[model samples]
Target: MHVVAIYNNKGGEGKSTVTVGIAEFLAANRNKKVLVVDLDAQASSSCALLGRQSLNAAIREGRTVVDLAAQLKQTRRPSIDPEQFLVWRAASEARGSALESMAMLVPDGDRMYDVESSMVWGKHNHLFRDWLKPKLTEFDFVLIDLPANVTKSAMVCVNGLAMSDFVLIPTRSTHISLNGLPRTFSLIDQVRNVNGDGFPTVLGFLLNATDKRNQQYRSIVRPMVAASTDGEIPPFFQNHWPASPALEAATDEDRDARTLKERFGNAYDHARKVARELEVACEKYERTQVQPIKLSLWQRLGLA
Candidate 1:
């Protein structure tokens, strides 16, 4: 499986929207089995995929990333079966049958704070990644929606980054939002430096909530953003998501059923195009990137 983390240190950049939209498109259109892991304590992606009611029920039952993270902390313990927390066919059945292959590991908003406070970064660093690598071989993609502002959830973000094979940044086109890109890259660099081989690489930037008429973005920030990447990967995705009420509304998780097209409304094409770009990135990363040798906990900790 090709694991991906949809992340940005800045908030309100539409990371969760991109995560859910791309996951649905990949599962429904590309015929890929997708697993969405909601690492954010906010659980926005989980609620979007499973609806608030189901997500709440799962949270009540202690079936969430918090539970998984807590369990994985005990290295001596047997692996917890992924199915225990995985919600199969997570999207609304009313949406379409195409999302049958989509699933999610919901999050707990209530207990995540306490969980993160207790976490020792080293002990939990690669625990989740190693536990998942062998058991989730059947999945085609694992899309992780990481919490914004790395400082707030460092442990969870580190683990998410270490688990992912690629990181897709979704950023708003505004100057403040664009300014956060460097920090995101800096954190990724730190993860790569410490984690060593197999650390996630930058997939590219997916501009979200863009204004087509904004000359500032078209003339200044856009090229500046592209140049910042130094042509490492495709600096910016060819397809971007524009700001639209319809697209924002799609994040709502109601009992009402809606097809993918109906859900995205006028933004259907945008979502599909973004998803296609993501698929291409995944294929390229898998084909050209070197596979990392599995390392023991002590090795990763520099204790061996």
Candidate 2:
């Protein structure tokens, strides 16, 4: 199985949304058994993909990622197996067509932040990596939705990402969002140096929620990007997500997967194209012993 982390260093980048969207696309279009691990404390992806009812039930049962992280934080005792917490048939009945083969590790709202703060460097950093690494061969794809900042939860993602085959950074084309790219790469560099497997090779900067008709993006941002030194940012995907409510609404309102497929329409096509790109990247990474790129951004940011 191929594992990919959809991550970034800043908030409001739609990482969770992209995670769910691409996951559904892979499950439906590619017929892949996808496991989405909600690594963020916010639990946004959990609410989106599994809905509040399911999440609440899971939390009550103490079968969420937050609970799992808490159990792992207990360094003295034997590590509890979080495999029992996997939520099967997570999507609503309406979404069965596209999500039937999909499984999720939901997060708890109350203890999530606590789980983040409880993390120490060694004991909890590899909690997620150690737990999920064994299941890689069971699922066709394991997609992780990481928290958007440099918190302890984010470090778990960074640690887990090092073990992944690919990592995809999702963001908008705006100045504030693009500004996070450099720090994101720098964090990757730190993980590469410290983490055993080195950094997860980035798939690309996925420019989601972009407007093709907007001249501002085409005239201003695209040129700056073209002229800029983007060796640290990795390559841009050929297909990108357009600004639209349908993408979030379908999941937010708990629409069935079939209806979601109808709502996204051509957007699903775009998602499929991006998934194909990821497929190729995963294959190439596994085939070659490519070394992780030590980005110069860490030096520029005075982080190295």
Assess candidate 2 and give its lDDT: 0.69
The TM-scores of all predictions, comma-separated, are: 0.87, 0.84
Model 1 lDDT tens row, 1-304: 8899998988889989999899888888788889999988788888777788888888888778888878887667557788887877544456353344578888788687777787776666676778865688789999999888886246866888888888899988776776676667667776776677746877878989887578868764545554435542335887899999878887787724356776677898999999999888788767444332223422332223
Go through the candidates in order and give the clash count of each: 0, 2
Q: Per-residue CA lDDT of candidate 2, range 126-167, in tens?
A: 655665476457788889888877643454565566657677
Number of the top candidate by lDDT?
1
The number of the candidate with the highest TM-score is 1
